[model samples]
Target: MRNGLSTFWDGRGFDLLLVGIPLAFLIAISGSALVYNVVMSFQEVGMFTLGSFVRPFAGLKNYAEVLSDPQTWPILGNTAIFVVGSLSGQFIVGFALALFFGLKFPGSTYLRGLFLVSWVMPGLVTGALWSWLLAGDFGVVNFFLRSLGIINENIFWRSDPAFALWSVVIANIWFGTSFNMILLSVGLASIPEDLYEAASLDGANVFQRFFTITLPMMRSTIGALLSLGLIFTLQQFDLFAALTDGGPNNASNVAQYWAWQLSFREYDFARGATVSVMMIIVVIAAALFYVRSTRHEVRG
Candidate 1:
């Protein structure tokens, strides 16, 4: 009788339909989609229409051509500069703000709210407004500078390749700092007060206590925040698209912008897919490294 009851329950509909089937379906669908895209990247895919297939097996030739292109390396370099510069600035500024707000100050709460307004704004609008301010002639920046006797004429922030990248970097830094600030502030608030008291008892200064105790306690949180920051910054496109449109001879062109240009402007879907795939690989690699490093820290 026990054996019979066990067999009946095992054959019931709940296990197969609710649990097993959906899990299998999800795995199948996600796996198939990933495999299909990876396969499509090997062949030439058109932007407008899928033409008749002549030969689909192109192998690593697409990847090789993409790597061999002169523009690829430069675009990647710009992406690196944008990511690192924006992230570094954002972290430093955010950490400072977090530290400031962690202390009691008049109107500090209101100031923190005001500071987050930039992060709340849409990326396209942020980029467009910054672009206007940094415009060469007739911009408010140039007008104000001339009024202050700083410059006789407008400065071409976009036209000058050297300044254009920095322009976008500044915009991104302004927008991204709030992310780090919020995360770090939460981490700071969560830290136990007893640790600080103990440090004070030991005659530790603010800087020393922060470095020795606060930093160690907040390490995991900071690591997570930084990983998320790197991922978002690496995939940054809307800001770049709206600000410079990868202009001035592609000086500000990043891998994301380059992919969009190829797919839409140049009408080369195959190459665009190649760029996208490479970006995926790079992001995945970076994420793995970050996760591994953080886990090691936790273990040690």
Candidate 2:
């Protein structure tokens, strides 16, 4: 016991202990939840059966039923749109912001830091703020559009089926842009100053330098950012809950919100678990790409 205590306090045992703690914690928390969720997807779970270790075996019944529902395809499509639209908007706007800051004007660091307001802010708070901004009657958004003659009347951003999902997409872009900008800025800053100077000496214009030097250097960063964005967008539930509630005829419905609605609201545990499992599969794939991107970062 004395020798073991000395070993633990002295050298490799400390390393082992540090590693073991996180591993054990991960297994205890995420591992158990993942396993239980996977198991529930294959069982016919109900209010009464939910308490049991085993229920009626469903096999592929839940999967089949979820896939067959008419709303299923539309919701999936909406999820796809939400992910793509939100990520694209965030990336484009964030990349522009990053490039702007890279120019390093007076107070640029402070200005760039200010844009992280959305990133540090709570999702619910952001959603509520946007809800007011996008409101039909008294919304500042419609008022501005009307003042500019862009729209003749108020646009019910959250309630209109045609605009509901896009409204959420807009808010999501605002919410996520800060993170994208910060990461992209780091990538931009890491490229050697000599490269830009050399390009400038060779008569390369600003656009030429960006395309030939900045972009190629940023490849791994962009890949990692995209993969992270995909996973982050998929897990966006609070924004939908606070803004749309998957309403206006489920027009804004996506998988995460729909999964919650199914399990808790509709008491369809099996289907809920199945939906989450499907999302998990997509996230896992995205995670693999993220790993690959990071690996390439090392190689670069």
263-286: candidate 1 lDDT, tens digit per residue: 788877678878888888877877
TM-score between model 2 and native: 0.95
Task: Tell me the tens digit of each residue's lDDT in model 2 across 130-179.
Answer: 99999999999999999999999899999999999999999999999999
Q: All models: lDDT? A: 0.84, 0.95
Looking at model 2, the pairs that clash are: none
Off by over 4 Å in 1: 1-35, 47-55, 140-153, 289-300
Candidate 1, residue 19: how far the Cα is off, in Å: 12
**In model 1, where is the ten-residue run with the lowest total lDDT?**
47-56
Minimum summed lDDT over a 10-residue window in model 2 is located at 291-300
* TM-score of candidate 1 relative to the true fold: 0.82
